[model samples]
Target: MKIGLYFGTFNPVHVGHVILANHMLHHTALDEIWMVVTPHNPHKKKHTLLDNHHRLEMVYKATEEYDHIHPSDIEFKLTQPNYTINTLVHLSEKFPQHEFAIMMGEDNLRSFHKWKNYEMILQDYDVFVYPRIAENQEEVILKSHPKVHLIQAPIVDISSTLIRKSIQDKKSVQHLLAPKVWSYIDLMNFYQ
Candidate 1:
């Protein structure tokens, strides 16, 4: 099976994520998209993130009804400071029968060169990049790389930060999250 690895902290899975994944699935040859919930993203502050299980549960609730969308916790067991190259290598070895592609936003592509062993990753795997609303445009060199595919997906402006802030402010986030996801957050009093 061909899988698109959509990795994120997913501190809380939101509708924009599911919609973007679904868009990628329809426009690409991918069979399924696994929303890999990262336990610790090197670029993000660990203190700001929720417990791993809580985040993972949100992903589960958000994607339960979609057959093509799945939640993954593959990074939780890995060593701290999870790197994309390492995760790619591990997934390749464990799922030898399947093919994997890195799914990311154009904003991330701008800094793709700075990632550890990024050159090696490009040489071995394909990268599916979607557009992002960034003040600075994505670097032309990386965007035009043979291994990097630019997908014309919907530009979703919704962000986890926005949702988190709203929740902390005790504002309604019903429109931003899936029903089950919102319910889960509400029941647990998360982000408040």
Candidate 2:
């Protein structure tokens, strides 16, 4: 089985995320996509993040109906300041039966070289990149790394930051997230 690993903080799972996962499943050769909910992303600001447990619950709520899209808390058991290379290495050892590929946005590809043992990651695993509107610089970077493949998933302009701000401002996030996820956020008072 070939699996695509889509890692994110998912402060609150949104529609854009669901759409992207669906797009990847339908368009790519991947059999399933595991939405790996990271506890802390080294590249992101910690102050803006929700608790990992809460974030994981939201992802679970959002993806519960879809068998192909799974919410994973695999990074929670791993060390903090989670790095992709270490996670990939651990996953490879534990799930040797499945072929794993890294799913990421073009924006992340631009900074791929800065990641820990990035060259080893590129050589050992396939990276699937979805285009981001603001990160056109990824093209230049991908030119240097032949292992990276550009995927034409629908670009989602929505981001977790925007959703958090909306909740903080007491604005409606009706369509931004799944109904269950929105209810969970409301129940927990997340981002408020």
Candidate 3:
């Protein structure tokens, strides 16, 4: 089976995330979309993120109804300062029957070269890249690599940051988040 690993912190799982994920899963040859809940992304500040369990639960609520989309806490068990290469190798070893491909945004692809053992990652697995409305992006060689697939999934402008801020500011987020997720956040008073 071919799996597309969609990694994110998911501070609060929003509609844009589900839309893009569903589109990718259905449109591509992938058998499943695993929404990997990143414990602590090296690129992001640790303090700004919600508790790992909270983030994971939100992901569960966001993806519970979908048959193909799954919430993964694989990264939470791995060693800290985890790199993508390490997780890839671990997943391959743990689930030898399945093949894993990275599902990332174009924004991350721009800095793929700077990741730990990026050359090896490119050599080993396919990368499914989605569109993101980003600014000041510079051209990079990896963007044109044969292993990299530029999927035309809908461009998602919504972000976890935007949801967090909106909630903190007492703004309505009825449509931004799944109803269950919003209820969880509201009941817990997260990000406010």
Model 3: residues >4 Å from true position, as ranges?
none
TM-score of every model versus the real structure: 0.98, 0.94, 0.98
CA lDDT, every model vs. true structure: 0.92, 0.87, 0.92
Residue by residue across 126-153, what tens digits does model 2's lDDT show? 8888988873543446534777888887
Which 10 successive residues of model 2 have the least lDDT summed? 135-144
Please list all clashing residue pairs in model 1, or write none if there are none: none
TM-score: which is higher, 1 or 2? 1
What 10-residue stretch in candidate 3 is worst by lDDT?
A: 132-141
Whole-structure CA lDDT of model 2:
0.87
Cα displacement (Å) at residue 80, model 3: 0.8
Looking at model 2, residue 127 earns an lDDT score of: 89
CA lDDT for candidate 1: 0.92
Per-residue alpha-carbon lDDT of candidate 1 for residues 1-192, written as tens digits (9 for 90 to 100): 889999999878888999999999999988999999999988889999999999999999999999999999999889989899999999999999999999999999989999999999999899999999999863556887898999999999999999999988988889999999999999998989
| Shift in Å, residue 72, candidate 2 | 0.8
